[model samples]
Target: MGNEDAVRDSLLIRGGFATLLSFLLGSTMWSATHPDDGSAQLVFLSSLAFGLVAAYGLTRPTMMSLPKRATWMLILTVLWAVLAFQEPTAHYMIVALFALYLYRLPLWWGVAATAVVMLLGSGIGVVVMGSDVSVVVGPVMAGLVAIAVAVIVEEVFMVGEDRRELIDELIFTRSQLAESEREAGVVAERQRVAHEIHDTVAQGLSSIQMLLYAAERDIPDDSPARDRIEVARKVAAENLRDTRAIIAALQPRALQGGTLADALRRLATASHENVPGLSVEVTVGHRSDSGALALGTLEVSLPIMVKSVLLRIAQSAMANVRHHSGATTAQITVVADLSAGLVEMEVIDDGRGFDVPGALVGASGRAQGGHIGLMTMRQRAASIGGTVEFGSAPGRGTVVRTSAPLEGHRLESQHP
Candidate 1:
């Protein structure tokens, strides 16, 4: 049971026992005033005192072992059974005992104990009042009510357990999603820093080496400054190589071989292998300066940044396809436009689709971690002055298209 429900039940049980004690005390005092007989009054007082003590003992601790609880219950039952002969109101206490027995004891044992006490109480009633057909009515009715209450409480406990499980699962899922986002952010920052170093530091070192060579050409052969200039050039060259290595290390594994087309094909092959139910195909193409389209060509050249963004987008798209799309076949397409100085990639899957607007909105807000893949893809594309679009609907398959400028080529041209 939840905390509130448990507390409420505890209060109710304690209050009920208190009320029962009050009723019994008043009934004993009334019997004393009537003075049926000295011995009868003594029996009534003893029974009332025993009941008060038993209620206190049973309700003292919040929890009790089954054996100990059953022992106290047995003692109370026998006391009430004996009191059934003397006090006229003593029989009603059996109803309260029914509730306690069923709630506290295991089902079978509770049922057995309740049945035994009920029979003993009713038998004493018949012996004293004679078989009036109403002898069994009270105990039977109380038993049914106690059973109903126990069932209701059990159902409430079951619902509480289900709610707790769902809450735990949600917490664990959110934790995993947060971890994934952190890792992705770290990787993106590393890639960005690598690209920055390649463009600024590595390029500067190369320029310095070229300038030093030019200066060495003008100097005399015996000049010591020429040797120092050559040494400086070698150092710059070595640093440039080191910078290139760092950039390579930061680059995605798929693009490490320096071939976008090959990397895409490998991605397709890997996706197909990893997702046994899905088959993947890759198409690399280019549009020439003459506006002619050529498909299935691997000679397309793209900037490193463009390749990196496109590959990451493709990875995200394929992941969605493999994990979410429920697709049987998928296709990855890359096309470079020579005239426009842009490259575009498209991932299409013939699978179940979803609401694009809703997905985008959820992704933008990072709600429930449901659309994180789409959000990451958009961010990766935006990093390179690119745009990604999704075309999808329910049962109509999905297409993720992204286009980015060739920034690396533009930078080289400006530098040259």
Candidate 2:
């Protein structure tokens, strides 16, 4: 059950239980102590009447009518006290105090009612029953006791209400915290993706532009070098196509055919064929149906911020492959496991590798900024609820790996 309903149910149950217990205790006490007195009979009847009245008042649906109820209950309690004075009885005064406690009447009203009832009941006992021995002290003691019980019950109820309000506030705060964290994660991811795109794809396109511009000036129209320029021109055009794809992938597509696998294959083919001397090979592992669903769902369902980040990561990786990797051959791998809800992608190059620390934190002597590629890649992965890592040394080639949790998305048939 919801928290608010549970609290209300508990309050009602306890209130009913307390009322019942009080009634039974008072009836049993009066029966045992004053069995012979005719006044005891009247006291018993009055207690019964008060119990019924109090029960009705306590359980009624009048939370919004509390002020009206309190005023009426106060007036009734006063009238009952005056009647007890004319024909005094122990049960009459007890019932009045019980009413005060149950309704949470004002302290002045409660004190005054208890005092007046006790004084009148004691005076009648002294005059009619000739019970003077205890009359002086007994009524005063009962009044004090009634007031104390009412105060304690009031305090307990107030504390309970305060605690319940606190719990509700805490629940609201927790919900807000969860939402804030999710938004922050999305924002952080986007920053990383943007950085990657700037470093990788942007840089690659710039280099290609420079290469073609330099070639245009050196080669004659009829020369074989001119053919080389044409090849470079085609490579630049193909690279532009891949760049456009990266942009499209970043956009939100309700339903685009071809799984993540197909997209990666197309990327690898375009990269290898477009870059004249480069050979790009892509491999796909046996994927679970669930993993495919998760990846596809992510592609289709992710918030715009997350999608943008992933696209930026892809663009950055391709850019790095073109510019930094001197190797003629490169490899891209894509793997997914549905049951595990895992999706992984890796880009490996057999190119010259540098110190990881130096690349991230530029060397002391070098004037230019350090390698931002790894940083951007890592950020992008983390933003999409994933992680990225790079493995490399001075002589060894570099490997960039990224992994993320997959949410299910329906896969559509690939178009030719």
Candidate 3:
């Protein structure tokens, strides 16, 4: 049952018990004042004691184990049977018990218990009070009515619960569909940007470099202007390489036919080749020894867009290490923590680092030029519900840690 239904039932049961106890008290007082038999005082005292115990039982928590509730019900039945023998009016308490049973137990068990109570009450009325055989009729009708009411209540609550579940399911499905559409739009935009850079910026740089090289060759072999042309050609060549790298960053081709682990390994190899005297190592697996996930858990479970974001961040971090960090050895570590629903990549280098805050501030940070890459890494992580943290100081080693939620994760907070 829902929480509200359980609360309402609790109130109704307590109120019903109060009403029955009041009735029993009144009947006991009248019987005692009239002095019907020597047992009048005994019956009055017993009724008061039974009322107290039942009231205390009603105060227990509404939600109880089946065995405990059954035991309580059995005790109440025995007490009610004894009182019915002493006072005929006590037989009416059976109606209250029947309602309680119907509300708490299964339908068939409630009906059976109701039958037993009616039979026991009727026997007491006819034998102890000397009433007619028709004494069974009133209790039987009351029990049946209580059963019908209980069944109707159960049906109403079941329908409400089913409707609530359907509404919740629709809300969840709508949110997931919206996320899927947003992801698709982001991918399409990235591809368009990559294509634009390839067709315009990269192509223009290539033409400029080729023209400069040809012009340099035509000049006299030792002419002073020939050295200047060579320098310009080299500058154009470097710019062309930078442009191509930007295109690759916008849309990573390394992830096309490989998993994230393979992509990282290739990136490390390329970084080692690009920077002389720098050795880069890639490690992909769990961080702990116990409860290790499968080697390809991330590749099989993570979305392609998320994997691309991680690879781009790793590439940017590695670029910083090779170009600026001046480190001899670097480590690229990827850890999948299934329990936390997060995958983290850390790039650590024993290189000369700079002031993080100083490099991330306003125009001054932008003036540094290299800090632009750090901001780009942060933006990329934010786009995919991830975070990037830099740990470094001047003359100290640098560590870049990036984390993103795995597929199907619902993080409480997306930012740190």
Candidate 4:
């Protein structure tokens, strides 16, 4: 792909230089064949050679030194202006220079330079050649026309830059979201295995132990049945212990030290630790019977993956704030409105927000920048039966809100 682009650009530059060269060469011929004045073709050829070399030097890659480019443009501008006076066909050469001047130089200087060249061409045509009034009006009209085209071209380049920025941000957001989803899947699988062990192997072992104990009590001490029943009870107890150990091993690593409640609390409070000037406050929506917040104070049957993804989404959103938005404050709020059958999570930032159209159009799927963060949040939430919303405008701040069903999407805890 890179090679193809290089070839295409090379072809374009070759074509443009060929066109400009032809115009200058044709103008030299036209003046040389002048019916009245005997023209100096040798001087025209010398100036043309110098101008072409200067054009090459000026159009080198941007990595080249600015002084080098300035020297080249200065040489070319002087040569092209001199050639315009000698050869009428060289007017086409000056037209091409107008584009380069606008592109290479600052706004005011480039315009002034191109306008001066055009005026010089017109003045030379009328005063030196003793020409008609058409020479005066033609160059002015052409100058206006060229400037209009240059303005449009500049705007197109600016829009391209904006799109490029959007694409870069999109790629970053997609990568983070994909990693989160993969982690969530692994945790969910572990929870499923733990669930199977608790509901099947552990329950069966308990029943066997109880039945063996009852049989041992019923049989006489001397009977063989009593001995077998006692041995069976011991075996069942040992098997139960082993099965419990296996179930513990199958639990997700993230939940081993603390419950999901602790992780959520940490996520909410730690958001603003790295970013200075930007303050964040965490607010909990659910409370226990003892009037304590349910987030970190009590164990809830929340999935470790759920807690993890929530934190990830929050972190990603905050990252966007720092990168894109120039906001000063951020707020994170979690509310498990059980009566409403939903656990809602919201991240609000007072930053430069984008226009989020309908239905949470997850990132545009282009690896580069445009609106990928919100798309990532929506996808992560939707995977686990949750809904994500985005709201923002140019100057107004951004709001990210997501909700998951309480019972509909709950994962069984390792302890439970």
* TM-score of candidate 4 versus the correct structure, residues matched by position: 0.67
Q: Which regions in candidate 2 have their CA more than 4 angstroms from the true location? A: 1-64, 75-79, 82-88, 91-99, 106-133, 157-175, 222-416
Q: Roughly what TM-score does model 1 have, to 2 decimal places?
A: 0.53
Residue lDDT tens for model 2, 149-242: 7678667767776676556545544564465456456554554574466358856775787788888888787887877787887887678667
Better of 1 and 2 by TM-score: 1
What TM-score does candidate 3 get on C-alpha atoms? 0.57
lDDT of 1 by residue, 305-406 (tens): 567778878888998898888999999988878788888888999999999999887555433344767766776778679999999999999999998886
Highest TM-score scorer: 4
- The alpha-carbon lDDT assigned to residue 261 of candidate 4 equals 46
lDDT of 3 by residue, 1-416 (tens): 65544754577767876787678667755765675668788777778777776776677645566677777788888887777777777787888788768766666788888888877877777887667756867777887788888789778777786667556645554564465457546765776686677678888888898898889889999899999988888888888888766755664467755567889999989988898699998887753335565543343335546777788789889988988999999998887776677789899999999898887772122234467677667777887789999999988989999999885532324200
For model 2, what is the C-alpha lDDT against the true structure? Answer: 0.58
Q: Rate the local accuracy (lDDT) of all candidates.
A: 0.75, 0.58, 0.74, 0.66
Question: Which regions of candidate 1 fall more than 4 Å away from where they truly are?
Answer: 1-12, 28-35, 203-220, 234-416
**Candidate 1, pairs of clashing residues:** none
Question: For candidate 1, what is the total of clashing residue pairs?
Answer: 0
Lowest-scoring 10 consecutive residues by lDDT in candidate 4? 1-10
Tens-digit lDDT string for candidate 4 (115-230): 98788778876764567777777777777777887677667666776677667656576577678678778767877787678789898998899888888888888997887788
Q: For residue 367, what is the lDDT in candidate 1?
A: 34
| Pick by lDDT: 1 or 4, better one | 1
